[model samples]
Target chain A: MTKEELKIKIEDILPAATFDETGEWLNILIEAKAWYGFAKQIRSSRELEFDYLFCLTCIDWKTHLTMVYHFTSTYRRHTIVIKSKLDRNNPEIESVAAIWRTAEFHEREVYELFGVKFLNHPDMRKLLLTDDWSGGFPLRKDFEDPINMIRL
Target chain B: MIEEVGTTTEGDLIINIGPQHPSTHGVLHLVITLNGETIKNVEPHLGYIHRSIEKMCESLTYRQFIYVTSRMDYLSAHINNHGCALCVEKGLQIEVPPRAQVIRVLMDELTRLASHQLWWGAMGMDVGALTPFFHAFREREMINEIMEETCGARLTMNYMVPGGVMFDLHPNFQHRVKKFIEFFKSKIDEYHELLTGNMIFVNRMKGVGFLSKEDAISYGCTGPTARGSGVICDIRKLYPYEVYSQISFEEVIETGGDCLSRYLVRMEEMRQSLSIIEQLIDNIPEGDFQAKTKAVLKLPKGEFYSRVETARGEFGVYIISEGGTTPYRIKFRSPGFSNLSALNHMAKRSKIGDLIAIMGTLDLVIPDIDR
Candidate 1:
């Protein structure tokens, strides 16, 4: 399906979602609360069985955190990107671990690096960072490390 | 969706198999919870050698970032660098010259073949066969020699730049690659004799690691790990970049979804890589190897993603540029990371020895996973 078709299909499922059409893939901006429902729908829906969650990441805009998800159907090969904005001070979003198992790992990586709380995530722990890591979220724009002595 | 098992309970025996164990390979720490001899849960405690390449890439220029990726999946360094280059080129909206495209593809296939050869040798060593390791390295040494001549370094050559490969092919690159392919082609049959048809080796791998087609997809397994279950997850075939669409090769798939099937798929893929090298070795177009671009590359404000089939699986480079010289945020979706996520599922209910066999087939590289 073309990006137009994917946009229409996704619009039907997510009413509040807005899309940015400039990128290569169809990009949808949705609310953080709506992510779980949309995730379940896309994974199981007949027209959009986005069974593969290839890349899940969180971007720090300093003021707000934007969660990004890149999904591609195994059979159809059509890809889509979903973005949800979360308040950087209290960044929290529903985990899609139950929907796509691969999100479990990516979510953990993001949780530690970006300091985003993945609510209902199975194993929400520091993945690439150590448990005793005292430095704040390394990926955050405001994060500082006395060890590296680098300040942004 | 919580961890199925990994928590220690009463009367459970657990063992730590390396942050440095030789069998686990390359600083991978696996915490195995056991019930007598049978495995209960295999929990991987990572971050041992994590250098945070993604965090570092945010500070480096687009050209400087590609070299750092070589350290992530060192075995498939060329392909990983190729993926990053393609992403940056996509952002810049420039086409690589035909000569450079062919050279990049040739280097990619050579790297894959060399990487698979090392995996074959190391995998054999992991599973109690020592002689095949030496046999596999004997041919890999030839590929390294070619890479050393052309790229000027062995592993992690840092050969690929943004627009194209940093340098043109060496004077004897074709002759040496052709000779190596001809020599390796004859030894393919001997590989079967030494390991493929050996019953002891066959029995050790045949049905031990059973990952179902659904589980393979759910776990986001790619390359031979997914193709072993009859999934066509080859990025070269699915989303061909460069001159792959022009190339003729079959993406090898095996339906068994066992350790043997995954092993067989790589063995078959090595032959396919050779065929690809054979096809392109003679037909490298005569043109400017590098496309003209500014010395300082600043990707336009947009999100660009490019995925290339590395030796292990799909290595994707996701870049979000804010119209700056450095990427705002860069993520390297190394294949071993997702493949490692599925280890617990595959290792459960199996013996401790089978863990090695399963891991051997998965071909986990520590830096790739940790990155």
Candidate 2:
């Protein structure tokens, strides 16, 4: 399916979801509270059984955090971009690691780099970063470290 | 602390496999917790060659970043360059000239051949066969000469650029490639004679490191690793990019899902790549090499993800842009990462020697894993 048709279909299914159609992919912004249910529906629904959660990462927008999930269906050969906003103060979201096994490592990486907590993550410990890392979320725009010279 | 230490009896021998061992291949130190040759657990300690390329890409222009990716998987540098060029082209929405696309495909095929040759040799050495190593390098040297003449670098060519390739095909590219093909055709039988049909090689690989199809998918194993398990996950076929849609080549699937099967898949894949190169060599079109684009590339606020079938598996690049020259967030979904994930699953029940064979069949370049 084309990005336009996918965007319209998503909006029809989830009326409250915001759509960004400018990019190469069909980006649908959803509320944090609805992320888990939306992910489950997207995975199992006949129209969009996005069985492949290929790439998952978090962006530190300073004021808020955005969790991006890049989904593609092997059977349908269609792609969808799902985004959910988290409060910058205490970023947290339901883990989709259970839905897509590939999400496990990516989520751990996001948790450590962006400080976005996965609510039901089985093992949310640091995957790449060290245990001694005490600086506030490294990827955040506001994150400043004299030691690392990280000035965004 | 003393009481806790007493309570926590060291049940297994903790052995550090390498930070500098020849077999581990580039500073990969595997902390194996073993119970009498049976691996209870394997903790891979990485970051020895972490040059922070992703972070460094923030400072480099789109053209310069192509060279950085070369270092990630040095053996398959052409594939990596193809990936980054495709991403930048997608961002710019520029169409590559037909000649450039054909050249890109040819380079990619040669790179695949070179990569598999190195793997064939290294994997043979890993299994304690040294003669095949020299034989494989003998063929690989021809491909290296072809790359060096055109791209100016043998290992990290950095030949590919956004919109198209760095330069037009060298005068001797076709001649050298054709000569290599003819040479490879005559030498192909040597591989079967020396390695594939050998009794020792078969025994070492046949039943070792068995990974079932379901487990292969769950762990995200790709390329030859997943293909060995009968999984059809070739990115070139699924998402046809470049002139790949116009070409005909087998996906090369095997059902054995063992070390031997993986070895067979790569060997077959090399032949398939060679055939693709042969068909496309003389049909090179005449046109501009690179499409016009602005000096500074600022990808609008959006996200782009590209997946390419690398020598080992699917190499994915995820870039998040915030209307800036530098990417907001960049992540590489390396094929080696998932392949490495299956190690504990594949190596747990095997002996120490079989463990080395399993690792070799996986064809891991440690920097790719750590990145």
Candidate 3:
């Protein structure tokens, strides 16, 4: 299906979701509250079975965190990007790992690097970093580290 | 490393295999929970070699960042660089010349052949046959020489730039590739005879590491790993980039969903790569190899994504450019990371020896997974 067809179908399911038309793929901006439900539909719906969660990442925009999801339908061969904004102070959102198994590891990576809490993530722990790592979310815009460390 | 290799809950023996074993391949630490001989869980501890490439790319410009990807999938380095260049090109709206397109496809297939050769040899060694390891590298060394001749590098060839390739093909590029194809084509039968048909090897691989189609998709497996399960996840056929659409090649699917199936998929893929190179070796178009672009490349503020089918699987480069020389955010959807996540699912209930067969067929380069 084309982007326009998919856009209309998404609009039918989500009336309040807005879209940004500047990017290559169809960009849908949905609220954090509606994200979990809309994402479930995005995967299970017949017309838009976005079974493949190719990329799930968070962009630290300083003031807020924008969660970006890149989804592709293995059957339909169409792709869409879903972006949701969360509060900078307490960034938390419903986890989609249950819907897409690929999201499990991805969500863990985001949680450790971006410090964005993925609600109900089965094993929410440090993935690439050690448990004793005290550096404040290395991928965040404000993260800083000294040039040389005296202690390991 | 196995400080505690004792019986866990319900008499399952928990054993940790290498953050440094030869067969595990590149710093992958698999903590397997075993009940006698069958595996109950395989938890992989990654990031030992993780240089935080994504964190590093945030500071580098679009042009310089492509080389970092070469280090990720070192075996399929050319294809990794191609995916990044394709993403940057999409954002810049630069049209790559037909000659460069053909050359890019040619180099990609060559890299795939080299990677599969190494996998075949290494996998054979993993399954207790050391002879094929020597035989596999014999063919691969030729391809490495071809790459060195043109790209001036053996393994990590950052031959591709944003608009086009860094330089034109060497004077003997076509001839060398043609000779290599002919030489390698004759060796494929010997490969089947030496390893593929061996009952001992077949017994170890067949019916081991079974991953169903539904599980393959759920785990987001791509490339030959997913294709081994009869999943049509080939980016070349599904979303053809560059001259892949122009070329005629099979997707190469196997429904076995076992170690043997994944093994056969890559083995057949080597033959397919030879066929692809044979078709394009004689017909490279005459044109500028690299397109003209400004010294400083600044992609307009937008999000662009490009995916290429590497030897392992689909490598997607997602770039969010805020109208700057350096990318605002760059995320590489590496294939090995997701494929490795499904290792536990594939290895469950399988014997300890079968775990080696499963990991071998997956053909993982540890740095790729770590990145």
Candidate 4:
């Protein structure tokens, strides 16, 4: 489907959705509270079976955190991006691990680096960091590693 | 301190496979729960080599960060840099010249061939045959010499920049690549004779660590690993970057999801890579290699992502730029991380020796996973 058709289809499902088509793929911005249902529709809708969760990450914007997901359909051969903004103080979102298994690892990585908790995630522990680490989320803009003196 | 498996009896054994095991190909720690040579679970402990590359890239400029990715998957360093360069170019809206695109495709295919050669050798060695390692490197050295002569680095050649390549091809780039392709074509037959038809190697690999098509997709497997299970996840075909759209090559697929299927998929992939290189090497157009760009690049405030089919799988570069010379946030979707995530699923109920066969076909490079 064309990007314009995708925008219309998504608008029908969630009228509050906004799109940014400046980049190559179509980016849909949705509310954090509505993400779980919206993601399920995106996967189950016959026209848009985004079966592959190719990339999942978090962007720390100081005031808030944005969770980004890139998906592609092997059958339809179309790609789309989904973004949801979360409160920076304590970010939490529903986990899609049950829907797409790839989200299990990607969510764990984001959990350790950005401190975004994935609700309902089976095994929620540090996947790439030592268990004893007590520093704040390193990917956050305000994170300061006094021991390493690493700040951006 | 270990968590017991479900309904465990008195004699269940849990073993540590190596944060420094030689067969792992890198520093990958696998905690295996064994019930007398049958694996119940295989959990991978990463971060031993986690350099926090995403955190580090926030501090480097657009041009400087490309080299950091070279260390992620050192085996497919060229493809890793290419993905980052493509993302930067996409953000800045720079159109690379046609000549540079062709050269990039050529280099990428050569890199794939080199990576497969190493995997083929190491896979044999992992299965207890040592001679294939020497034979595999003998062919790989030719490709490395060709890369060194042109890109000026052996493994981590930071040859790609935002707009185009770092430098134009060397004077003998075409000659050397052609020679290497011809030499490799002849050696491929020898490779098949030495390992592919060997009864012991076939017996060890076939029907070991079977991952069905549905499972491969659910686990996010890509490249030959996914293709071995009859899933068409080849990024070159799915989302063509560079001149790949114009090239004609088959996405090698096998119905058998065993280690042998994965092994044959990679073996056929090497042949396909040779064909791709042969098609592009002769027709490299003569034009400006690098497009002219500003002294400093500042991407508009937006998100840009690009993916390349690396030797192991699909490697993606996602950049969030806030109209600055440096990215506000950068995330590398390395294939090893997702591929490694499926090790537990693949290794379950397999013997201790079969784990080596499974990992060998997976062809993991742990730095990529940790990064």
Choose the strongest candidate by DockQ. Answer: 4
Model 1 local distance difference test score: 0.90
- Model 3, A1-152: lDDT tens per residue? 88789889999999999988777789999999999999889888999999988888999888899999989888898989999999999999999989998889889889988999999888888777776788788778787667622112
Off by over 4 Å in 1: A149-152, B1-9
DockQ of each: 0.57, 0.35, 0.51, 0.66
Model 1 earns a TM-score of 0.97
Worst 10 residues of 2 chain A by lDDT: A143-152
Tens digits of per-residue lDDT for model 4, B172-259 = 9899888888888988889999999999999999999999888888788998888899999888987899999999999999999999
Q: Which 10-residue window of candidate 1 chain B scores lowest in summed lDDT?
A: B1-10
Per model, the share of native interface contacts recovered reads: 0.60, 0.21, 0.61, 0.70
TM-score of chain A for each candidate? 0.95, 0.91, 0.95, 0.94
DockQ for candidate 1, C-alpha atoms? 0.57
Please give, for residues B86-153, the per-residue lDDT of candidate 2 as tens digits: 88777767789998899999999899899999999999899899999999998899999999999999
Q: Is the docking of candidate 1 incorrect, acceptable, medium or high quality?
A: medium
**Candidate 1 chain A weakest ten by summed lDDT:** A143-152
* Model 1 Cα lDDT, one tens digit per residue, B175-231: 999899889998888988998888889989988989998888888899899999888
Which pairs clash (backbone N, Cα, C closer than 3 Å) in model 2?
none
Model 3: per-residue Cα lDDT over B1-371, one tens digit each = 24568986588889888888988988998889988898989988888888778878888888899999999999999999999999989988899999999999999999999999999999999999999999999999999999999999999999999989999999998988888887888899999999999999999998999998888998999988999999999889888888888888898999989989998999899988999999898899999999999899999987888999999998989888789988888888899999998999899988898889899999999899888
